[model samples]
Target: MRSYGNKLFLFYIILTGSVLAVLGFVLGQLFPFYIVNYFSENNIDLDTDQIDYIKKQFAFIITFLLVVSFILICLINGKLIRNLLDPIENITQTARELTKGNYRSRAFAVGPANIVELRNSVNLLARNLQEIEKIREIENERLKTLIENMGSALIMIDREATVSIVNRQFLDGFQLDLDEVKDKNFLTLGLPKRIEEFIDHVFLTELPYRKQIEIEVNQEIQYKQIYGAPVVGEHGRWLGVVIVMHDISELIRLEQIRKDFVANVSHELRTPITSIKGFSETLLDGAFKDEKMLISFLDIIHQESNRLQMLIEDLLELSRLEQHGFSVKIMPTSLQEVLIRAVELTSPRLDEKNMQFNVDIARDVTVAGDFNRLIQIFTNLITNAITYSPENTTITLRIKKNDEYGIVEVEDEGMGIDKSEIARVFERFYRVDKARSRNSGGTGLGLAIVKHIIEAHYGKIQVNSTVGKGTCMIVYIPLRKKRN
Candidate 1:
């Protein structure tokens, strides 16, 4: 027996059935008596005395039917009570779960049918919670991955300069341990004096500062620029500061490279362009008077034009190769044919350097690639060796075949690349000997072009060099494309 609803239901059933039963009884009494009295008074010899027994029997039947009707009403009242109470009980349970921060919990339908509004409200809340959690997870993962992989070191500190978070990359890059440094005062830690003072300044002012700090790592001094900003929380609360330490070693190197490239390009172009302009100007000024002078000027002009054209062509080729989605058709081509073309192109340079050429292209070393690009690649490498090597030095072009691939190599006993600069030799406009590179009439782009063209063919190019001894360039190329 539930308290309020059950008691109200019992009272309603009893009261409603009692009133209806009384009304039915009244009607049965008055109507039956009237009918019987009318019959008795109007009829003659109609057996009125026996009719009284009939009226009594009729009254008894009406009383029995009224009692049965009251019983049906009580049953219906009980059903209504149960239906109302069941829904209330379900809602109460759902509220209790919600209070426990079970945001995903939902209410169920109860009683005769589900209440649409209650179920919809609960469902809406759960859906909102699900969507919010999903978004939070995605955002958290994205940020975590970003921090873990970013090249710069990242650290977070409170306004009091207490470290809060230090990414693993930052920790390893700086040789720090979080367990050892956590909850420690930066000013008293083994940090450099300048950095400690900077931290103290930031904490006192609750502002940010960017400064250059130098640290020794692995016995080498490294330079970095550290930038900080105040981290604000809800209601303008000053939570902490976020610090980003950016390594500027590469940046500094690139800056120097840019300055050097400008000077080199200007100096190189000035001499040739000046020669071409001077010779043309002299010829225009009636220097054609001497047919010999005219011929000499024309020869110099042709050489200058060719040099300019070669440099421009190399620049354009590099630009084209760097573009994304660039593809080459890998077709079967004879290695001998490629070598012959490269030799034909470099015959002038080889003759100028007085170098001997020996080619041993395997008859069976047929490679699959863009034939024209491969020719350009080898032509550049051979020309470079011819330009760098001394007179009468033997340059070798060896081509061979394996079970899976073809190989081509250019070896020379030249003023070889330094071991340190060997790795960067293929970079754009890089020259191991800047002075010697200029004197040799190099545009400093030949090897870079070779590198890109080989890579585009899905081949690899490597260089082995010793500063005073010699150098070898190796190219590995696939014989055929594997089926995907």
Candidate 2:
């Protein structure tokens, strides 16, 4: 561009100089002829010396004027050339900056109309590019935030099969760090075999794949719904593969529980219904004529009906407790009073089992809970103890308090549960001794109900048991704070 400007300036200078030299030659030629014509018209004669001197003076003047005019015109043309090219040069520089990702640069709009317009266009382009860059940055930030906070674990692999991106959930779920996973080959990240296989399948096939996979972590089984697909860019270019894992362990367990619950309910209901139907039919088929048989059958039917009623009521209670937003009425209640009432209610069962309560009241703790619900919790616990313990066994009831909670423990000298089964005692319809519990008129929902009630009171329950020694049920309820 600079060379082009210099050429243009040189052309102007040459054109101006050529025009001045031609005019000077024409005037000098005509000057001699005109002077000779005037002398001839006036009847005057000129000497050779005078003509030669005048011609010499005219030649010198013409030469001087032409030289001065050419110099002045060259200087003016130089300034004009710079004015023409400066804005263009600025626009070019701005374009270079734009290519280098410097969108903030702008050309100066100072030149002729066309050059200034060009500069303005470049500036406008820079503004648009800057705006687009800003929008892109904002969108990228939004995408990053969404990925980081999303519920499911996400991992992105590049075309080279290297781990390019991983979300927080992915890192935490896999117990991994960014430094360990990033830039590492997907196959070499020590991921679970199942997950790695799935990722490999997607990468090889370059297609979408989905499956429910089981992975063991920390000695526990976890269920994940895995979804993987090949990521494609514009023009259908294959970029990489993305894998998303959603933890569904809880959902799977709940589904299994649902199936078990349906089966259990049907079996439980059928037993008593069959007993009542069989006994009633027997009585109707002439057994009622025998007074002894009739009374015996009637007793059996009455017992079956009672058992059915208890089962139904327990099922309903558990359903309500497991419902969403189920709340218990909370108040400052005397834990000792609640325990006493529960003991009184279960005293009949205690007598039937020939069980004695060893009441150990360390402190009458005040707890924040629903009074009736608290009584119900203890009542069920005591009833379970009495049902499970042998005759003449002592059930110990202890009331104690810690810094933050009121602790109640129901310890019984019963056939203790196995360690493996201890964790499942709170499940509905789960019983350690199914025959004994059913024969003792247990609905099998007592512990489940007790668990829900305690949880509603913002408390926790723990069980400690040995196979032959005894079982201890501990309940921890938050203590009520005193007001000044």
Candidate 3:
């Protein structure tokens, strides 16, 4: 720019100097002719020396005036040219800054009207660019926040099949960090094989795909509902693929439970109904004529009817306990009293099995719960212990306080449950020994009802057992704290 300005200045000086020299030469030549005419017209005789001296003076005066005019013109033109170039120079610098992403830079609107207008246009462009950048930044922040907080795990892959964006849920779900996952190839990130295959399929087809896939994490099976789609931009440009995963393990488990419940209920009901029908039909077919046979058939029918009634009642109780917003009556109740009442209620069963209760009350712990529900919970536990244990085995009942909870444990020397079956014990109609439970007249919803009641009290239940050794049912209930 400086070089250009110098060249322009030089050009202006040369042009001005050339014009002054030409004018001076033409006036000097014309002055000689005009002076000679004037002298003749005045009737004055002039000598050659006088003519030569006057011509010398005239030539000197023209030379001095030309030099001064040249200097004056150069000075004025230099200022004028500088004024013209400075605004353009500023606009040029501003444009350079804009290209470098400095939207705040602006040119000065000085100099001639045309130059000023150009500078104004550049400034307006810069202002618009700055506003657009601000808007873009805000939108970017909003998108970032939404992705980070979304409930489902999300991953975005670029056209190169590289992980480009991973949200917090994705990182946490996969037990990964951003540095470990981002910029890595989608298949090489140690994702579940099923998930990787799904993503790969989407990328290859450039189409939307969805599936419920089973995956194992930390040795536990999980069910995920995954959705993948190819990202297409303007002009149908394939950008990449985006994958979203929703953890549906609970939903899948519930669905399985529902199916099992339906099958189990149908079977359980059919068994007792068939028994009642068969025994009654036998009696109707002249078996009632023999008093002994009639009594025997009637007894069998009565037992099955009782069993069926128990099953229906247990099912109703479980349904009620499992309902939403179901609450237990919470009041200060003595744990010792509840356990004693449960033991008394189940004493006839214990006696029938020839089992003895080894009661150990560490303290009369008080907990906030329904007294009747507490009795029900312990009665069911004790009854189960008797039903599963051999005769002459001692069932140990203990009540103790720990921290904020009153713990009641019903430990029995019984046919202990296998570790794999322990988790399903509380499931509706789940039984370790189905035939034994049916013969013992258990409805099989005892543990399920106990679990719901415990949860309603904001408490917990834990089972510990080793096959062929013993099983312990530990119930933890929050203690009723005394007010100061």
Q: Identify the candidate with maximal TM-score.
A: 3
Measured against the true structure, the TM-scores of the candidates, in listed sequence, are 0.52, 0.64, 0.67
Candidate 3's residue-wise lDDT over 1-484, tens digit each? 6678899999999999889989999989999879988998999899999999989999999999999989999999999888878878889999999999999998974977888889889999999999999999999999999999888999999999899899999998889989999899977778889898899899889889999999987656889999999998999998999999999988988998999999999999999999999989988888999999999999999999999999999999998997898999999999999988998999999999888999898669899889999999999999999999999999999988888899999999999998778878998899999999989999889999999999999999999998887899999999997889
**Please, what are the lDDT tens digits per residue for candidate 2 over residues 107-142?**
974977898889888999999999999999999999
Q: Order the candidates by TM-score, highest first.
A: 3, 2, 1
Worst 10 residues of 3 by lDDT: 213-222
In order of listing, the candidates' clash counts read 0, 0, 0
In candidate 1, position 225 carries an lDDT of: 87
Candidate 3 or 2, higher TM-score: 3
For model 1, residues 1-484, the per-residue Cα lDDT tens digits are: 2677778887998798779878877877787777777877987344656777777777788778778878888888888778777676666666677667676677775544356577667768777876887898899999989987887888777766677777776778757787866766555447555656666666667777889887666545567888777889999999887778888866866786678767766766787889899999999999989999899899989988887776777778777887898778779887778888999999988888788888776465777888898898888888788877889998999988777678888999899987667757876778887777766667888887788788888788888887766789999888865569
Per-residue error at 377 for model 2, in Å? 1.8
**Alpha-carbon local distance difference test for all models:** 0.78, 0.91, 0.92
